[model samples]
Target: MARARRTATRWWRWRRSPLRRRIDVAEAWVLLGAWLLAVAGGLLAGLLTTGTVERDLDRQRSERRESPAVVTTDAVAAADQAPVKQIGARSVWATVRWSTPDGSAHTGRTRVPPGTRAGTTITVWTDQRGRLVDEPLSGADAWLRAAIAGVLVAAGAGGAVWVGGRLVRVRLDRQRLRQWGEEWDRIGTQWGRKTG
Candidate 1:
């Protein structure tokens, strides 16, 4: 039993050498960098993309607010009332009847995405030019945007994790190779000798 214990201890000690440790450390750093970079890139990309979308939406909103138009909201009663029809993905084209500031109503066609659904209350703005626009987002709309953003963030996190794992694996392999080299050197002089 004592001899067996000694053998096990010897084996364990041989497995962990300085070269192996160095390789392990180096590999760790590589993976750490990969993970950090992936995370940073993902965050930056998400921020830029989402920000761009928000800015465009905001610009359109402001334009609608500034125009000499009227804003009105009503529930879409049926298919006839559907100002925009869901045709292609996020593409809707329809004509809608909306009110004006002078207590007058006009019917005009508007093109929007398919996100607007039947039975949803939509706000419409019409200018003196007879150009009609709709408020695409409401309180629930903001929440939905946030949810989409959250999904993008999650995807970024996943990318980071994947990169980190790859880096860790690379480091482990380097460590093993370094350890093997050092072990070989140590055993070279005493090759075929039973002592080592």
Candidate 2:
């Protein structure tokens, strides 16, 4: 019963009462609208961002291809070059030459296993234009990226709505306070007892 009374008290602005001022009603409406917008807007933003990211990943997977390339230079151990290991293997940068389907050749630098000798065949990813490119994300990776993007976009959208609502509520509160001060001044002057 106590909890029910507290809930009712909390919603007093919505109840019809002589004490319920216009500002109270306005504040209640603002709170409700902010909650609704935050939920709906967050959901919409999340879905759109997720879909866009997934589609882009899918397009990349479709557009990129792998080609065999020959190592033009021996690869140096990554530990010798950098203090921190970048990946699983001690990979090092080396120049590689590859031929496109159109018989055109291209040379690019890519990471290769440490101590990789020249003339070693290695698979490299490329775009439609035959330029060397990073391999497209795997299925699991794409899903993870999309999920993260969706969550971040959703949180941002919700936060923006919350901030906007908070600003409006603060302005309303200030206005109410100013009006109350003016009313009190008038009433106090009539009583011949002015109080700051």
Candidate 3:
């Protein structure tokens, strides 16, 4: 079958044949090494990136806590703040006050629903010292983010190896072409001529 010939041709570099140049054997080894590097480097980079990102997110979640705060100013509609399109309930910046675990009061500006009046209690996230902070992602969300980062890093590593291998192969092909061209030039001029 045609497949049998194709299989044999694939291993031609290892066979004894005048057509097999040193560069051909070297190209085979280069390709093999490139594929191996891509696999090994991709796995290492992916695991390292995923672990670092997940650990950082986990640390953020552990250091932040939720608390209720009282808004001291009326919130304006988001439309009034800007002309940009917004989805869901309109929100605005309003000053809020909350107490720390040590009974110390702290105030900061945070986003609240439009039309919210003074003295309305709203849930907020804070650091250990009661400073207003953004909420952290849950474990599942963190894992998902890490997975995406890992995949991108893995793909990048593999792509770099593939590109490097292609460049090497192109250079080798040019060398072989030049060699053939030189031989053909010498042979073309000697047609039907005898030299002793």
User: How many residue pairs clash per model?
Assistant: 3, 0, 0
Model 3, residue 146: distance off in Å is: 0.6
Q: Against the correct fold, how does model 2 do in TM-score?
A: 0.88
Candidate 3 residues 87-162, lDDT tens each? 6656778889998888999999898887888899999999987888889998899999999999999999988998
Better of 1 and 3 by lDDT: 3
TM-score of each: 0.44, 0.88, 0.82
| CA-lDDT, candidates in order | 0.57, 0.91, 0.87
Give the higher-TM-score candidate: 2 or 3. Answer: 2
Q: Least accurate stretch of 10 residues (summed lDDT) in model 1?
A: 66-75
Order of all candidates by TM-score, from best down to worst? 2, 3, 1
Model 3 error, position 97 (Å): 2.7
Error of 1 at 155 (Å): 2.9
Runs in model 3 with CA error above 4 Å? Answer: 1-7, 77-79, 83-87, 102-105, 128-131, 192-196
RMSD of each: 9.2, 3.9, 3.2
Q: Write the per-residue lDDT of candidate 2 for residues 91-150, one digit (tens) a residue.
A: 788889999999999999998888898899999999999999999999999999999999
Give, for candidate 2, the lowest lDDT window spanning 10 residues. Answer: 1-10
